[model samples]
Target chain A: MLYIALKMLMADRAKYTGLLLGIAFTAFLVTFAAAYFSGFMTRGFALIAENGAADVWVMDAAVESVEQTINMPDSALDRIRGVEGVRYAVPLALGTVDARFPNGRFQTFQVIGVDDATLAGAPVLKDGGVPTVLRAPDAAIIDDGGTSGKLLTPVLKTDQWPHDGAHLEAAIRELAVGDELLANDQRIKVVGRSETLPRFPPRPLIYTTFANAARILPQERHLLTFVLATAEPGLSPNDLAQRIHARTGLRARASEDFKTDTVRWYLVNSEDVGDMAAMLILAMSVGFGVTGVLLYIFTYENLKQYAVLNAMGATPRVLLSMIFAQTGICALTGTGLGLGACVLVGEITAKAGYPFRMMWFTPLLGTVGVLIVSLTAAAISARPVLKLQPAVVFAGR
Target chain B: MSTDANHEIAVRCQGVTKTYGTGVAQVAALRGIDLDVRQGELLMLVGPSGCGKTTLISIIAAILDKDGGQCKVLGHDLEQMSQNDRVRFRGKSIGFVFQVFNLLPSLTALENVAIPLLLNGVPRGRAEERVRSALDSVGLGERMNAYPAQLSGGQQQRVAIARALVHNPKLIVCDEPTSNLDHKTGQDMMDILRGVAQSPDRALIIVTHDPRILGFADRIAYMDDGRITDIIAGKHRGQLQ
Candidate 1:
């Protein structure tokens, strides 16, 4: 019976091929979009997680976004450092600054600054020398995650931001190492680029000494934005966070919570490239819908032969089982091919400096979606098939 | 069991009525048919259009349900059986040949023949052997792999016959098996059917319109307006003309 089922499916090779291709194309786009969206968000906010050295993070209150630069005084960092089970405290500043390059092209980047001599105490994103950037007063390191190459293109302020709608393509041409950038006329040279540093599209990234960062965006008198505290061994991380929140009037969060906060921040408050993402998602969904419909048409055409089988004393259940089994096999095979396509395309697209990435979890989701949609398409054709009366062949009327 | 098996009737139907739909659209396809096909007899049903020969044959074959009275093929009563049970009974004990040669287009000749046996839960290999022997019996040994479209009309019809007899069913009901063939081919088909339809243990009931088929039947039944109006007297075999 299974052989008969397979034979019936294979008889219409052209139709089955078309169905497989349609399903594969739909699955590829949906999974790829989901993966890129996930990968983009993860790469964008990696710095906050790296810098938070505490068993938990304690912020002032109601801070929805990490890039918003909520402030606390030096008294808070000092207070957390003195709390029991706390090993060390590092004061950090995250601010936006206009970077002027030697080529007179300027761009903007988020400047992350931490007061740590070894740079291990700072989230370096694996910059070449932690000691150099950590100690350099006028020197800062850059992350190459979004940069085209090893050279870090410094983005200086072209004109006053928040008022000037200056586009990036014209402002910055080529960012390379050793290029000098000016922030409020304070000159600094670009150091080596780090590999996994936090960045967004158009390279919203820069690194500088805490004192150097204070020059462009001055810190309020006796104010600290985030305190990075290391936990001593043998101390429960959650317990330490509780003790810190109890001692200092601030919210303490664990590492997972800290990551969640940053993700929540960008998701809710930030001006995301929303239209592009929405359009991509819609395209993916429409592609899947079209594939499903086309597959339904193809499977319906294929079942014309099976009607003859049923009329020959093949059971109706036999017909159904055969069609669904074909759907399952085609769905699984097509999804495998689609996943392969996504991986190959993702690599090429990523190298071409696009935001596409390959994530296995999202592709699994895509496989499930494809299977359901394909089978549903196959199921839609059952009406005409079951209605194929044996008498139809003889009477032809 | 042996004594009864030797003398038992293969097909019997009494006061069977097949009506289609209701109200103004109502039609009695087979008004009321009383028929009995003895074991091993090759019976041919002949009639013109609207004569209900096919409908009567269908009821006797257990393919269509009768609106009134009873039909029994082999041993089981049609009215008392479940739908699936009826189908299974037909697959196991009876076989049918249509004028259209309704073999699945996707299957090879051998596979087409094996379908009945396979439906009976006979494994493929054994089914294939039976199918092959049946095909050989119909002289289609060289064309096992060929599809119905690939075969000539005569060849396809033989494949249909082979399929019908592959299970060695006790009752073989063929509707117009020779109507689609040329005279010689039709005669050849009857010869093969007569060879297999012989024996006191099996019966063949065929519904056909060709006068040339009268020579091949042990008994001939005539239908008109869904009623079995006349049956050629057994003593006047060739003299009925």
Candidate 2:
């Protein structure tokens, strides 16, 4: 009976194709939006992930995330270094400064200052390992994707640069080594280039010694933004963070915990998070709406065949099984196609430097959503079939 | 079982009444039908449109519920049995043929014929073998793999008959079995149905309006307004017309 049901479903070519397409489109929307959202979250926490050597980060008590920087007294770094479980502690300074290119193109770049002696928090250099160039006078290292490529392009009257991630990447890549730029009237030279993870709204990223950073900006009594720390042998990062928090009277977070905190902060504070969530919900609605209507019409059109089966002494269970089998075929096939489309789109956007991360759970989430759509459609469509009288086969020819 | 009063009767209906709707819209399909179809006989119920031939057969086939009646099929009281039990009884004991040859268009003739046996829980291999033999008996062996759309009307009707006989049910009911076919095709269909559907313990009932195939019936029951007005011997061989 199931075999016959399948054959009957396959016989109507137009309806079958329409149903499959509807299901596939729904699956595609769900998976694509989820992957995009995952990509956004990964970018949101890039600062924590990029500083691989740091096991703990000590910040001001009021600071919730890396994006929300709160300056701490420079004395906090030394206090954290004296904690029992700490192996070593280094100062990290994060501040944005205005840079004017030699071509008079003015832009703002994120300046990260590492420990002057150890270069402990510096981005890994592209070719020159561990960047000794920062020791030079008035020297700074720029990201390979950061400067002298498209970032230095003068802002056009008509706004030639489209405000998107790809355009931002092109802007970052405009700067190069051996170029001198100005930060707040202080002359600085790009001495090296390095590769690093991209953050959201790609900025011109500059790395320099803490001393040079201090000299370029106005002097202040409290200069440290965060203190990056490592755990001693046999001590977990969480334990080291707790010790630092206790000793220094500052908020200390394990690196992993800091990443979670950053993501949570963005969720609560950013409109982008809400926008991505809305897109995901809309995808799910489209999936259910399109697939449900198509499946219902297909089943309704084939009611007569079902009636024949009913009259032939098929129980409700048998008929239900047949409908379920049809749903399974459409649901599984649609999910596979949708996921495949997501992977294809993920590749294309990634090449264009767009943020899109398809995790295992995203596809799993998509499959569940598609299954719900198919089953709900089947339940709605099966009502008429369950009530069909076999005697309908005896009606007008 | 041998001493039961309806032992030799394939179907027995007494005071069976079926109404389509209620109140002002009420249409009584069967006023009070009393019918008995005996074993080893092909009974033809002949009537015009709206005369309740199809309704009476539907009640006998256990596919429709009568408003009030005592309807027994092969000693099983249809109204007394639960819906599930009645469906089970119908699956294992009865077969049906329709004038339009209600073959599933998606299936080949062989698969269509195998449906009844499969519904009765026969394994696929054995059911298919029986289906093949039944089609062969109806002289449709060469066209077993052909879909109904690809076959002629006469050939399609033969496949329907083959399906009816494949499960070896005790009774087979056909409605308007020859109404869609031309004279020669209709005659050919009747020949196949009458030749393959008669046995000592099995019975066949056909409800139709065509008189050209009357010669194939063992007895013809003429109906008018849901009542059996006359029953006469058919023009079957060695029987009075």
Candidate 3:
């Protein structure tokens, strides 16, 4: 009977294809929305999220999230280092500087200064090397997602530039090793290219040693933005943060707690995050509506066959199982196709410099949405079958 | 009085009554129907449109409930059985052939014929074997893999009959089994049905208005205004015709 059900469903090629397309389109929309939202949320706290080695972060008492933090005095790192249960503490300086390219193009760049001795906060270099090259005078490492939002070598756009002088976001080049640029009127040379976590509304990221950052950045009383710390082996990060807070009188948080705080702040204050979440809900609602209605129409069109089966002595349970099997095939296939397409698109967008972070949980969440669509469709489609009278088969031949 | 021939009765109905709708819209489809179908019998029910011929057969098949009556098929009271048991009994012991040759259009003739056996929980391999033999019995052996739309009207009807008989049900009920066929095709369908109706332990009932196939019935019951007005032996009726 299940085979019969499948045969009956497959007999009408147009309807079956229409049903599959309906499910696939819905799944794709849901997956795209979820992946985009996941990407946006992850980028909201890129600095905190990317530095997985740090167990705790100490900043000014008023700082709520990484993006909204105020600069703290450089002495805060030394005080945090002296706290009990602290393994090591390093000063991190993050500031925006006006960078003047050799072509005289001026763009704002976010300059991050990690500890000169440890270089603990620098991103991993694309060439599988450390940022030790930043140890050289007036040298810095820029992320691959810099300047042109791509890793192209720095060059003036002319007859020789790729894409017919049209700068493609994909073809734009980051500042490469030995490329000189002016920051805050100080000349600096790119020493290496590193791959860093992406940021929304992407800006060029440049890393330098603490002493160099102070030179490239405008002078100020407080030069450090955050104090990255590691907890002792036996102490939990939360406990160590509490100890740091009690001793230094500055706000402190575990890495995970800070990440959560960042995301929470965005959720509360950023309309973009709220709008993206609402868009996700809208996509799911549309998916449910379209898939459910299409499935219902498909079932309604085949009601006569169901009546024939019922008149042939199939129990309601048997008929329901057949319907479920049909729905399962559609749901599983659509989910696989939609998710596969999402992954492929994620790859394309990531390569093209679009913020598209697809964690494992995003697709898992999309699958749950698809399942809801399937169950809703099955439940809605089953009503007509349940109410069908087998005697309808005897009507008008 | 009807002659029993000392054979066991497959279907017995007494004072069966059925009504459609409710209130002023209510129309009584059956006032009272009392009939007995015996084993080894091929009974033809002939009647005018809306005369309750189909209603009576549907009730006998346990697909519809009667307002008041005692209807027993193969010694089990249909009214006393629960819905699940009725479904089980129908799956295990009864078969139905529809006028439209209600073979699932997507399935080949072989797969269509295997539906009843599958519904009854027969393993797929055995079910396919039985389906092949059933289609072969109806002279459709070469067209086993042909879809319904690919087959002619007569061939489709034959597939329907094979489906009806594949589970070896003790009773088979057909509604307008040959109404869609042309003169020769109708007769051919009747011939095939008559061949399968010879099983001594099973019975067949065909509800139809087509008079050309009357000779194939072992007994004919004429219905008018929801009552059986006549019962005649097939041999005697053939002589009169």
Best TM-score goes to which candidate? 2
**Model 1 — TM-score against the truth?**
0.82
Q: Report clashes for each candidate as comma-separated counts.
A: 12, 12, 1
- TM-score for chain A in each prediction: 0.82, 0.87, 0.82
| All candidates: interface RMSD | 2.8, 1.3, 1.2
Error of 2 at B71 (Å): 1.8
Off by over 4 Å in 3: A49-53, A71-75, A95-113, A116-195, A204-223, A232-239, B1-7, B236-241
lDDT of 1 by residue, A1-397 (tens): 7787677666767876876787788888778887787666666566654554556666776654565657776678778988988987777777676766454456676777767553533544353455365465577766554765333332654431324553334344445556566776777666655555436544646666667668755435633567766678988677777888889868776666677777777776666847557877797879678777876776566554564455445666777787788778878888888888988888897787666656567898789888878778777877677766444433321
Report the CA-based lDDT of candidate 2 relative to the real structure: 0.82
User: Given candidate 3, what's the lDDT at residue A205?
Assistant: 82
Model 2 Cα lDDT, one tens digit per residue, A138-215: 999877332334345323412322443123222232455667778989988888777777776467788998988887
lDDT of 3: 0.83
True lDDT of residue B216, candidate 2 = 90
Compared with the true structure, what per-residue lDDT tens digits does model 3 show for residues A1-397?
A: 7777777778888888888777777777787777777777777788887778899999999988877768987788889999999999888998888886654556778889999999988877888887788899998898744235433344554412244443333323556677777899998888888778877546778889989999999888888899999998999999999999999999999998998898888889888788878877887888778888888888888888888888777889988998888888878887788788888888898788666778777788778888887878888889889888787888652
Report lDDT (Cα) of residue A131, candidate 2. Answer: 80
